[model samples]
Each structure stands twice: as C-alpha cells, then as structure tokens.
Target: MKTVAVIDYGMGNLHSASKALEHVADRNTRVVVTCDPETILQADRVVLPGVGAIRDCMAEIRRRGVDDVVRQVVASERPLLGICVGMQVMLNHSEENGGVECLGLMSGNVKFFGRNLKDAAGNKLKVPHMGWSMVDQHQPHALWQGIEKNARFYFVHSYHAHAVDDEVAVGRCDYGVNFDVALAKGTVFAVQFHPEKSAANGLRLLENFLQWSP
Candidate 1:
C-alpha cells in the first residue's frame, strides 16, 4: 500500500491532518502521523502540518530531525503538502518570535500583517486574520482542481507568505493586504489556510491532492 506520512513535530495538528487526509485518501493508501524520520522518509507522500510560534516550531523540527527528512522528500520529488505554520516554515525566514530562520525549501519569507491592519475600505481588521476568506486561484495548479476560483478557506494567523521567487502567486488572498495563500513548485504544494477546518471546498482540495500527479 502507498503510505503518506504526516510529520508529528509537537507543533503540528496531527490528529486533524491525519483524519482529513484519511477522509480523502483511498483505502489502499496508508496515512501515518509520526515523528520518526524513517517513517517519514519511507512514505510515498508527506505532509507538514503545524500550528504555533515559528521559533518553537523550528526548534522542535530540528530537535526531531524532521527538517532533514523533509529536505530529502523534496529532493526526491515526492508530493509534499505544507499547511499553516508548516507552510510558513518552508520559507527562508519568518518575522515571527522576534525572528526565526526557516527550512528555506522555497524562496520567500513570512511577514506580519502589522499591528493596525485595515481592509481596502480602511476598516480596522484583527491581527490574526481569523475566519473564512476568499482565495483567488491566480495561477492554476493541480491541487486547486474542482475548487472555485475565489473560494473561501479558514485562516488563523497574523503572518503570511509575502513573495515566492518574485513571481506571481498560485493563490492570492486579501485580508488587510494581498498575500500568497497557496504556492506550488515542482511536486510540492503548500497552503497557508487550514483545509481541515474548512468545509466541502477544503475536502475537494484534499481530494485533488490525492489524485494530483504533480
């Protein structure tokens, strides 16, 4: 059976991610949420799901040696998905926790939305940018199959992906500012929103991922 390993680095949402993946993944596919490097390395596909401070997330990821495993996964061209802080940690650096260095799997950095964030109309917006927001699929990708053009997804974070390789974003959303929500390079695809917390649209995205070849 094909295996999909969801890395459990303490800062991740293991239960929710595993359940979500299992819900979409076929019976022939095995989903293993583990902290073991070998388990992750052996998997046909991998997911990096996280929630928490970037500083602590990086600390625990390195402490558990999952960072190296992820690098190997990308190097080998296995399909890898990063959710929330998991997506943030794949960047070069993050301004969270005073400042934290990331895995640099992708070319970019995470940034804060600012203390006094306001929408286009200048309405005061919250720091975390919580709740459902529209995600515009500007650049088409396999993971977005069956999902609407500007579908709403659950978001709960103050930081967001700023720029990716200085090119157009695959998915862009406006909270108080325009930021990248979904990114794709090679076989790797990442989203800043929590698809598990999202509804049917979220499930569709996951299903697309399972069927996606690239």
Candidate 2:
C-alpha cells in the first residue's frame, strides 16, 4: 500500500484533488493538508496541488520549510505529481506575479498563454484555456495509463509550463497555441489539467498514477 501525501500549503484545491486520488489509488493515502515539513518528507508518494500564483505557492512551501523536503522527494526518485499551478511550480522559473523563482525541478520557464496568438480564422482566442480540453499525447507515460490519445480532460489555467527537453513533455494541448499538457521526468510527473474534475478519464488517469511503479 502506498501512502500518498496530498501536499497542502493552503494554496491549492486540496479537497477535490484528494477525493479524486482516493477513488483511484485505493491504497493507503493521506491528504496531508498540513504545513509540517516532516509530514511531506515521510510520505511514500507526494501530490502537490496548486491553484494560485507561483510566487505565493513557493512562499507557502518556504514558510513551512518543506522546500528542501520537496527537493528530497524529487531526488529520492519517489512519485511526485503536481497539478495546475502545482505543475507550474515544477519549472525553473515563472513569469507570474512580476516573475518569481520556482523549484527548478524541471528546466523550463512558465509563461502566460496568448503570448503566441495564432491566426485562427482571422480571430484571436482567449487566454486561460478553460473547460474540458483534449490532451495531445507526445509519448507513452504511466500518468496517461488507460487514457486514450487525445482524450478530453478538464482544464482551467492561464500560465503553462514549457519543458526544455521535449522528451520530458508527455502530453500537450492546443489552446490558442500548443503547450506542454503533462510532463514526466525521472520520478516527477505533472499535469496542467484537473483530473479530479475530468470525470471517468480523469479517474482512470489517477488510478494509473496509483498503480504506477518506478
């Protein structure tokens, strides 16, 4: 049984994310909606949930002094999943809230959408790609287990992650433009969409993460 620690820094959609994982993992998992660094350190698996600014998220984790623990989890080769803003923090830097430093877990920069507007029928699309969108598969990854290629998943985000290495980008989605939808490098896995709010496909994705073996 894997003890998944749903990291709570008072900055993410904690409850819904936990509920989704619970339905899928079926293993020993706890929503550590705590600021205690030890709680995050001791867990076998960690899920970082986010919904706000990257700087704030980093600040909260730093306030709890679990930044090192987070790094440790990344270094330990344990399963670490980030969602939405959680996914943004995985990058080396972000251009949100006047720009801020990030975990640098993955070598890339997070940028706001609509920066590269494509001519779509001579019309510009909106930022914050919201609602249910299809995840474009880049390669085979465990997080995408039981999910069909180009499966629709719920998403609500303005900023997006861009991996320095395309190989790390497991999935992508086209908003006004195409961006990394999901990333998996080493033991770290992250998604830009909210599987908790994505229904059946989302649950299956969560289940795969639960059963995923390094």
- Quote each prediction's TM-score: 0.97, 0.93
Give all candidates' CA lDDT scores.
Answer: 0.88, 0.83
- Candidate 2 per-residue lDDT over residues 120-141, each given as its tens digit: 6767666667799888889898
In model 1, what lDDT does residue 176 have? 80
Compute the lDDT of residue 3 as modeled in candidate 2. 78
Model 1 misplacement above 4 A: 166-168
* Residue 83, candidate 2: C-alpha displacement in angstroms: 0.4
Q: Which segments of candidate 2 are over 4 A away from where they belong?
A: 27-32, 115-119
| Model 1 Cα lDDT, one tens digit per residue, 1-214 | 9999989989988898889989998989999988888888888899999998999999999998888999999998989999999989888999989999999888898999999999889899998989999999979887888888899999999899975664536899998888999888888889999998898988888878777787
- Deviation in angstroms for 132 in model 1? 0.3
Candidate 1: RMSD to truth: 1.1
Q: What is the lDDT of candidate 1?
A: 0.88
